[model samples]
Target chain A: MILSDLVERFGHHPLGIGQEIGRMVTTPGLDNPPLNITEKELTRGLRYVAVEAPSGIRGRMGVLGPLVEQAEAAIVVKNADYAFGCSGCARANIQLIYMLRRKKIPTLEIEYPKTREEAKVMVKRVVDFLRGLGGTNG
Target chain B: MARIAQISCGTEWSGIQDLLEKAANMVGAELFFPEVDLESIDKAVEEVGVNAQSPNLRLMTARAKAVVDGAPAEAVLLLTCFRCAEGVITKHAIRRYLQEKTKIPLVMYSFTEKPKLGELLIRLEALVTLAEKKALLARERQEGITLGIDSGSSTTKAVVMMDNEIIGTGWTPTTTVLDSAEKVKREALEQAKLNGRDIEGIGVTGYGRFLLKEKMSVDLVQEELTVVSKGTAFLANRQRGEAMVIDIGGLDNKVMTLLNGVPDNFTMGGVCAGSSGRFLELAAARLGVDVPTLGKLALRGDPERVKMDSYCAIFGIQDLVSGLASGVSKEDVAAAACRSVARQVFETQLQEIDLRQPIIEVGGTSLVDGLVKEMGEILNADIVVPRFPQFGGAVGAALLVSGVV
Candidate 1:
């Protein structure tokens, strides 16, 4: 919530997968029935994955690729347990992180909070990272 | 206020609120996060079946119990993370369970720690729009003088309808969204020999629907998913029973299955424009012929003669260049491009659809006779082309807005 407030304050929209999937599931008359995603959106997703990837990658990419496209900057959490964040399709997750790196956008990699003390440090790091993006769009 | 039931594992554990307040406030929706005790989690795990030994997954299903137990939820968001294998499998299970178990609208999202706020606002806005404008989606008939404007990626289209029959249609290449909309709207009105004063209702749709609102008097603003199917059905005169509708437009393609003019399933977009009418336009530019001429020449050649089966527009064009350099006939090259687009749409979109008989093909590219023929041949089905296919979105918007007006 603090991060969201900060992102909003910084004049940048936060690009998240949840909202993209929500758009997909709610989008009327999409080709991906049972999920509300369009085939064209799926094709956009398909462009991200190599042809030789596993079958389920299409659906995941279809959700993630749009968010990545909207991102001006990214904040990736490092050293978080598998339990602390979204670990959707493992293959897609790794590739998406790699994609963020390759994008060469302003990125801040913070260690996940483990303790009360570590949590404070993480917040300070986040504040600094966001401040560093001053005068720059996220 | 609209109420959303959130079914999730580890949302709080991820240390984000899912921007709960922000999303809810944006949509004027009330968000609910149900809690399950350890006892309830244990009992629920049996029915949930597969959990990655993650209590979070178990708790997630337990949380879903509220909806099944008859809680008032206007929508449901099934959330998991991107990396949780067990959670993904479990999320799918919960999805199948909820789908089979309930009729509530379900939205699935994978959240990361510190998710972006703008994206969530967009989702919430869609939910609000779906709820508020639902009347536009389920209208069964149209009456009176109504106008619809469709501002698309490549073209602007307008249709004037009177008493359920299309009186006039205006089409122009899209340049400025508002200007193009006004031009097409004026053209349509001119053709109908009716001034704007005769129109009782006006609706706008497509990529520029919202833009028109600031400049025009609009009664309905709708998404193409429901409106397009409604339009196609009305145009094809297939408003009852089961049918499939395909629209190959200047930018994307839309394929939908409907029962009684309501879409139960549909997809909008090809793998790329290579699989859409835009590719046909590009192919015509390359072949030094108009789109209609390309269609005529395509009819004269065998599709199997020149190999240009690329489904990506850039690569598809490269294939066209390669085929031409190799001394392939222009007629054969046109046929291959048409057939290639047809084949790509078939492989990428149609394969996943529950195809109904009497496939109705609409949109500008539907007029390209050879592409239509190839698609018909590829599917072994007769493709129905409604009169004035290009104004499908316009017609649909006009038809749907009539309900509200």
Candidate 2:
């Protein structure tokens, strides 16, 4: 069974889940296996997908690891949490851009929503980014 | 038949190495007491086995247990009790572990007191008899006689029992703990009219046990608390539950907690004659009076009130002299000294733990009527003083010898 499945079955509270996960990872044995999934493993499972993120340093770094291991198009998702230019999320978005650029993967970035209409527009950008990757799944 | 081992650390007189040798001398029993880390103990046991390849050995805390030729044995753990200020043994745990692991009859002797050479020989005889099949059976069926001795800083005491009728008790001033101990032991035996040969087993308790061990010899040496707790529990005829046992001595103070019929947490102060029985002695010297009469004089105060803040024995005396010049009644001054001692003891014991009611105060110091009365008021609780608080430790030691039966 997956590590997340085990955590879900046993972890009833948020602190409990966090404590269990911390202990599980810290134990001497049972660290590797079907539980440790990589970007290449995700590529084999997914035919069409969008890696959405906010534009910044963190975003650019986030996609770098996955793009280096597997070719995939990226789409940055934005919500009101990033309003007024979030420095933390922006750093993550910048990492994702650097990752796709280094690996020659197709990518796109979009602004987060200010209203309900803007949120719909952000979803459409993610769909269009996946279509440009020569994918089929909406 | 399961094999057993008993590894002892030291004798009442000797250190760790000598104790190891004593354990090694047992017939058909394996013995191991390590000088260093326990990782080497398992290997040492194998090399010294009956067939030179026996694999039944278990290394435990401060001692070892093992099986030799399908027989079980154990080692004793000796520790000092912080509260009662005596050395005691965790003997039963060692015995039970050996019995459970190797399925052999296991026992242990915790060294606490020094016994005379004659007493040591009797204990050795008891051990051999315990291991021997027929003698062990007979001793168990008949119930053996055990004696206890408590050598204090100021006095030496002995408690004797045939099977537990409180046969006789002995007490004498301890010039040197070991020397006084020898005299007390002789006196107790004389009182009981039992020769060393008639004694089944002997246990020693108190701080002076080591000094006595160096002089003479004994079987088991254990802490004062185990001896005192058992004895006090028996005398009181009820389990002393979470109650603070205050032992106010001539030169020092001791406080112990009897939690769930066991003496667990406790504390002790060094030689401070001012806040103990010594305070009364000093007061008696200053007034040119005796100790017993000092208490009654303290009760005869017309004012019935004197305040002496200094707890230092010498400084408090100076304060008392100043108060006397200032027209403080001698009775009130005496009462003030009592209050000083009581306050010091309470600050040391009651400040930390919740002292359960009905505190049992022991020691010759407790005989002071004014002290006991003032302490009762200060504590706002009932204080129970035994008939003879001075002999409590010796009585406790004697009670220890007969407990397991």
Task: Give all candidate RMSDs, comma-separated.
Answer: 17.8, 22.0
All candidates' lDDT scores? 0.75, 0.51
Candidate 2 ranges with C-alpha deviation above 4 Å:
A1-138, B1-144, B302-304, B403-405
* Cα lDDT of model 1 by residue, B67-174, tens digit: 777877766777777556556556656765675677555555566796666445434544454445555565767899999988888899999999988998999999
- Which digits, one per residue and each the tens of the lDDT, describe model 1 over residues A1-95? 45666676766666665556667678765665665654455555555553223446656776787677767788877656765535355656655
- TM-score of chain A in every predicted structure: 0.77, 0.42
State which docking tier applies to candidate 1: incorrect
Model 1: fraction of the reference interface contacts it also forms: 0.00
Off by over 4 Å in 1: A1-138, B1-71, B75-101, B105-136, B350-353, B377-380
What TM-score do all the candidates reach, one by one? 0.63, 0.48
Q: What DockQ does each listed candidate score?
A: 0.02, 0.01
Cα DockQ of the candidate 2 complex: 0.01
On a 0 to 1 TM-score scale, where does candidate 2 land against the true structure?
0.48
Give the interface RMSD values of the models in order: 11.5, 33.2
Clashes of each: 15, 50
What digit string (tens of lDDT, one per residue) describes model 2 on residues B1-405? Answer: 212233443242344344434443532333433333466555533332211111121233223332432323332222221221011112222333343454233333333343233222222332343344322122211135767788776777786776555566778877878778878878888888887777766667776876666666576565564455555555554363556677787777766666544444344555567668888888877777877777777766532355565778888878777778888777877777777777666644343333665687877777787777767876788888875576667665555544433
